[model samples]
Target: MEALGTTSLGERSPWQDLPSELLGLVLQRVPSHAGRVRLRAVCRPWRDGARLQPPLPPLLPLLLQRDGTFLSLPDGTVHRIPVPDGVSCLMSTGTGSMLFLGHGDGRCSLLNPFCRDTTTPQYVDADCFGFQIPSGDPIVHNVRKVVIMSDHIITIQKTFEGYNCALSIRRRGQSTTTVDVRWMPHVAAYSFDAELFQEKLHIILSTHVGTIDLYVMDLIKDDNVSLQCILSTPVDNLFLPFGHIVDRYLVSSGDQLLLVKQDICKLYNKLMSAQFEVFEATDLSNGHAQWRKVDTLMGRALFLSAGCSMSLPASDRYAGAREDCIYFLCELGCYGIRKENLSFGIYDLRKGTLLSLPSETMVAQQGPQIASWLFPSNT
Candidate 1:
């Protein structure tokens, strides 16, 4: 106890010697992942304490840039990662600094890029890479997004004319068990994306007839699963002029689920301008779920993309976070790598304005336009 307050006989007490119990309390109050990383940089004791206790809200995710490089987050430092040949990072999985790697031959692996000992953790054959799907249907699947949990991998697949969107759930060390719930919607309906929110998985399906349906799936005990319709809301008429396009994204934020709509206007596929509308669910659990518009997201910010969409606190500008912002991908033309074509920006919800990523980050490196946000798992 005295050591915490008093220095050594002839020298000052260093931060490296701070008690683990005391350090953990400080870590919990850290508002951003980058803040924790700075604390870990102090000394071995601080680093060990970070790994042992595991800070709050997990670590800030690394931005996987186009050219197989990693943007060191808030700082925006670029790192070239030599991923295994023929394998690509599918997304971030597990806990800390780990990634889900997809092999060219159709297999998956889990890797922690920070470590040298790389061992493939899990495997899903490319045969379907589709969660041990039964060999009966002959439809080419388009997976919207995959949520990888500790014990379960839930994939939300796209819908086709005759085939309904399928949610494939596969667990580890078990017989090929799957939660195969095929939702048959209108042939004209388009599946936007899926989100794992509030212990349940939900997929958004927007019909051409001006309606949005939220299909919520609950994975229950005894391997039982059930589907519920939470938000089946109608959209206002957007009697639009030519060259206007709208895309909706479903994101799970803090304690609420947000439905973000991106309105893009273009001429001859050239960039014009865009806007975002944010909405919150009123009666999320009740059968009659509804969405109400929210001008500000309190102090939280969102990162939106096709591969992954998530919400994180933006309370700490010192840790490189901005409040009430939506970071989105906007490739002017077909998703491409052309310097002039790669258009990305951060939309300030509070100000109702858009801001581009730093100019340095924009021209640093470019690869496949398909980039992903990764929150690593140490486990």
Candidate 2:
């Protein structure tokens, strides 16, 4: 038997030195955010061509903190994402693309996480004045929510004033998606809160009365989307309109359709008729028709946030404290709710378990509610 030749020289590369593409694939599966961060710093070619990749499919939901940062809960674990330049907004639409609106510009941009491809519609200006009036009068504020589905249907709703536009989602690498509004009268006073339920896109609108009008559109549907009346409020006098501008009119908590209405008359009489009814969506698939009155958060309340209970188990209760949970930029920020004085306050629903970051650390976050869809394990 011939003896195998032994090489005295230094050995060559093992595993035949993987291809550049294969090396990148192996590095990408490292599973650590830091590992990916390090991989980006390895080489310029790697960073640009291999490391900084587009987001994967089945986009994950993320919440943007007040500090202009995005938070993601991976497997119930929190992960902070680095913001790239030119990114004005970091709203995770749960559509595999984060919504980025330009600064002081009418154009809104959608960035794909997987492809790193961006689509910008310069003419697409969304009005966002919201559903809050300073003197408690409902007026048109030009605020609107525009949703673009994967299948290319755009549904928009103007806040408070009820202006709505249903336009065809413009094909990428194309020009105008605008319709000939000159021939038709514009529908005014349309309000909608959008969510993805049962693998379908559901836009919930409200009527003159408290009944909910659900527009169910399959992301894959090319036919005309239909609007169906789903549920009506139990109380006659109660109009489950959009909560104050601060409250998230968009399907509160990603699931429940929140309607915050108070009996101002009852507050004046100092009676207990101050009811903030919460209707739980029974079935979001069939056009949000089935609803049940859940519970009333008893008190003269203001804003709500999905937060953890600092002590005991961190429950997903609304975070601000009544005395200490002050709303910044509102009424001089002293009278709203102070985060420090919440320890022994009565009207505060924190139950002495409210978790708070330092007030100095927390700048003002806009909107009526602050929410985080942490992984189920985190909650």
Candidate 3:
């Protein structure tokens, strides 16, 4: 009989010695963030091969602290990542391989974490800017969010003057997404927030009248991708169109579009303190959808910020994460960006209550919200 992990000839099993190319191919199929963790634990060769994979898919979201430490979720794992000097992770690019990083010289570059040297960076050909960054353009100064998706890149920029804003959706290869601009008479006046749902790009546009509209860009449609309005504030019957609305986030939950409304409770230091309300879309099949207040998120949890938001299922592995809760950051402005001063909290949907991060967890994080939320590509 053949011995364990051995052939009839008594040779050692070759399972540990797979080819690099084949390993890379296998790694591509591993979509779950948690699944990757188990994949690396198989053996030394497997771990090494997984690490050597060209572009590491973003693992479960981590809070990037001010001092280059990573605070992982659910497990409360504290990791000190060796980030290079003068380079700071600016935000997630919606992909695991590259991120938008900021330098000391007011310059920003695209950083691929899997690359050999974190010290050096070059320009990424995102090409939506059409102009060099740091060029003193008012538009560049107020750039709010830049999300890189599979088909196109979405850039949202807001200027303080009259709350002016613009949404530029550009395809990767020198073209632009066909947006339905007939409704938007003036791009500068309309302020909006966007997210991806069901393989489509969705956005929430807030107008001066206090009304908000939800629109979706159907990329998978025919040859021409077009934007279509799905719902508006009046139809939702939930949002009252408050002028005090400062930030609204669109989080795509499992087959659900969740809206997180943040209203200004207090204005201090040119920033407004946040108060939140959750709403879930209803009857989406007919295009004209309505919204209803969502008291719970089932077993899923949400991570949100001014610029980004993500939803994930709470599992046993993430012991620190609470189910049906929303996790967010607040600017305490006490220690001037110290991790301790950046107040983090988990809001319980069931009880409509909030619980702050424990003292130990806060201390592990550095004070920074550069990358608003790190969403997994698989999601």
Candidate 4:
């Protein structure tokens, strides 16, 4: 009996006889989503194998800006996807959606550009939220940062009086409750950055006196949510002279919380350099916590920006991703003297090396725009 596809020469394509198990393995190793899509189009057998394979984790976070343009880092490709109409300013971004603030009317809404879903418009009075409209400031000015979680929205704003950190909680079939953290002592001179972890809120504040403080607050229905101080450490003398110019970020990875500190120094008019340090929460059992300096992330990669911070494994399957490395999209210009220049790069923890994105891959923009690391949803 003759075997399948066996002719006089006894030659056949190896891919034609590839087993399903091996095909599945190949599909799993395909790093980029575009590659996976192309693999499915190769042939019927490969398509079937692709369908059987599990969803692949994101290789690199996409850089999304307020202008409805995004750059995919894997291939340095830029694509434009318009946001909802009347969205003049981008406020925050979440799982698969973005929060937008209107131009002159203080209108706010949530938009999922990929899904084309826009929530009902809600009027927002920035003054009521502790933001003063300085004589000629932009409508959405003075907002340092914003974070949107499952059931809450947090904002850090600078007002005429001082800095204000507000948390707005929303629940199904209930009116939203707004809570302020102004009651916390020594908050006036500091700017805050917050992240939601394990159903609670973790915040890090950088004070004018070159001190860093960490606070944990519980989410409650009432207005009196308790805020507890977790850690307070004075920054080194190098940062003491800069005061509030230093940047601090709080990120939660697995069961631990990480504090990333970036110290910026001005070299000249527009040139600047930065150094980074990472600390991890070592003791959090039984409601007690302590922070310790961490040298590495143990094969994990961190993505950080103004919106939020995320951590994922730096698997060997994904090229260009290194363990104990951080991919940051933040500003790195001279503090208080000139406008911040938005930058992106990878910071290696093991080698203490800072690698900037290739110039050709960066968007040609003159001013700072809303940029963050976005994980594309499979759906």
Candidate 5:
């Protein structure tokens, strides 16, 4: 009948006396996923506490390069992880995972590097999508860009004939549906980027005359999938000269859809500067939508690149992450010169200030290295 911490018990362990809530707080303060994993290994109670309160959004984004190096943000600590065999290059990144293209046969797989888990390799046939590249040709080497949504995959390729885009939609217990669209010289229906919103695919199209258009497609429909133009706007004058280097990113934020247009410029195979503009979709009552220019993200931070486009709240839990800003990693190519390089920066929408990341912490490489933001996985 003695109390828990009475003299009969002598001296209790410090960790045992610590409250669970306080232990959880301590675990939450550890930013790196590996750090949290080590903390959980200390004891059963610590593991339980770590599992109960996983790091929330605004968690520091990790920069994963094609060479299997993970550069942690805010602090810029570098860690090397083994790349899965046969992964030649990075294609796209999803929630807590990334899609990579195989070096041998152009097969793709979804890999969660933190947990070292991967999905079965699946071949993405370009001929099935639209363009008929030779059987021996590597699809990843030919495709200009690849995007992966929940169950859909989109690829844009430049063939000898012209540029074309293909959309493949696959649902559980259903066969995949593929759609191919060719870019016409005078038409403005070419897709630049695509994202899923409310289960429907939204595509961003560009014209030769600097016009930007948004088209929505219904993938669930049984019949042919046709794109309906929702919004059309013109690019600003400043972005006109860099049209060849322009890339569009479509991101979904809650009930709203965001379009990020970025232009990266290079000088002598090195990064020069980058610019961005964000727009939010509104209206949509009578088969029509309007895109309004927005300067602020309202406490949300966007990480954008050719590999992925994602948004998370810039919460206070993540130090050095500012709200209403964008963290960008993109490749800048100089037309005709055939030179390009990667660039990284943080752009504050409110003050219109662009700041470079600390160069000393960046990974030193001889050539351009592909970078994508990898979010922490619960697994």
Candidate 6:
């Protein structure tokens, strides 16, 4: 023990000679998070391993920032990412890639973190409509936005100031490849894109009669981009089942989609209906659509809402309790939750077995944004 602190005999510390992996393992096992941060500053080997950015792993947890910052947070630290300037819209499609919307020009950029590359889809021509064929045909799909629909790809419908709107799909992996799939002429007047299932891409349409219609595209076409609305359960006044639930209760964990819905049964007791769903990346290639409610999630409540709000930092600075979590201001107040849990939760989706977090500690907020790392483990 004295040898670690000894300086007289001119003896070198044995830890200096340890393998890189061993040092990393030792660092990982440290209990105090602050200690780990200090250790990284002690040597070059430690710093590299701690801050390495490998290929974006499948199902990697992500945090969507309001100020055009979309990040892959593993331990509660922020890896500053350079995004396209003037991007006003951002959505994490849960595919280690983000769908971004830019201002000035209504252009779409599909960014893949794993590949560290960007695909700028072709621009939409005014007064015309186009769609992409999944058959290696590439067209810049400049609909309202772009979404990966299971085996198919769907773009939001777009409209020009003086022209009609259309949809298009750009081929994958090749530059300048695009195919248009406009299945029906003037179908439903207009349609908005949404993630229906973990893998299934859907279109939400409003008919002339004011009835909202939902059409689930058939993924089995030669072009692999076709639509057939899901029948039996027609769209009604309660057209927004998911939106309504999110307005009340929903929380998303890393790859776990939580929904907490409130219902009044019998004569008047409000019951919280919680559904826990997990999205597995393997399912995308195996025909297992987007998200599936994991039956085991059925249980009790974890958190009760005062209210929830989406908060962003005034500047580019980002901080959080743990690497996987971030601190941002909401209308309700400041709180902590893993960054990946932002999308689906009790407040966003009325579902999931409730359980209190392990600890409740005070964290500082910086101009409506709270930036900090998680407390290290106790072991």
lDDT of 4 by residue, 21-77 (tens): 887777666666556666766666566666776655446656775444777666776
Root-mean-square deviation of Cα positions for candidate 2 versus the true structure, in angstroms: 12.4
Q: Which has the greatest lDDT?
A: 1
lDDT of 2 by residue, 1-379 (tens): 0011122464433433335676555553543333455555554455555534444211122334433444432222334444345433333333323443332233445554433456553434332211122332222122233344454424342332233423223333334434312111133323345555545655555444444444555423443444444554433543434422212132333334444322212112121212233445666555546655544333222232222111111212323123322111111111122232111101223332223322323333432222222111111
Q: Write the per-residue lDDT of candidate 3 for residues 52-71, one digit (tens) a residue.
A: 77874333466655455545
The residue pairs in collision within model 1 are 94-377, 95-376, 95-377, 95-378, 96-376, 96-377, 96-378, 106-126
lDDT agreement of model 6 with the native: 0.35
Ranking by lDDT: 1, 5, 4, 3, 6, 2
lDDT of 1 by residue, 1-379 (tens): 2234335664545766778888887876664454566666766667777787853544345666656666655556666656777663345431224565655555656566766445544465643335221232212224445666656666655544343455566664443423333444543464456777776677787776678888787778736667777667777744656766666888888888899998777554322277899998778756667888999887888877666778878744344347888877643442223444544567898888777654335433355434556654441
How many steric overlaps are in each model, in order?
8, 23, 4, 0, 0, 67
Using TM-score, give the best candidate's number.
5
After TM-score superposition, the amount by which residue 204's alpha carbon in candidate 4 deviates from its true location, in angstroms, is 0.9
**Better model by TM-score: candidate 2 vs candidate 5:** 5
Q: Order the candidate numbers by TM-score, best to worst.
A: 5, 4, 1, 3, 2, 6
Give the per-residue lDDT of model 6 (tens digit) for 1-379.
3335335786665555557667656665543334455676665545665565332111212344433332333343334456566443344432323443433234445565433567544543322223222232222223344455434444555453323334454344333334545543254433233444444544444443434344455555445666654421222344444423312222333333333223212222112233323222223344343433443322221222212211111111222222212222121212222232222222222333332222211111122122211111121
Model 6: lDDT of residue 324: 18
Clashes of 1: 8
lDDT: which is higher, 1 or 2?
1
Candidate 6 accuracy as TM-score: 0.43
Which 10 consecutive residues of model 4 have the lowest summed lDDT? 170-179
Candidates 2 and 3 compared by TM-score, better number: 3
Q: What would the TM-scores of all predictions be?
A: 0.74, 0.44, 0.65, 0.77, 0.79, 0.43
The ten-residue window of minimal lDDT in model 5 covers 331-340
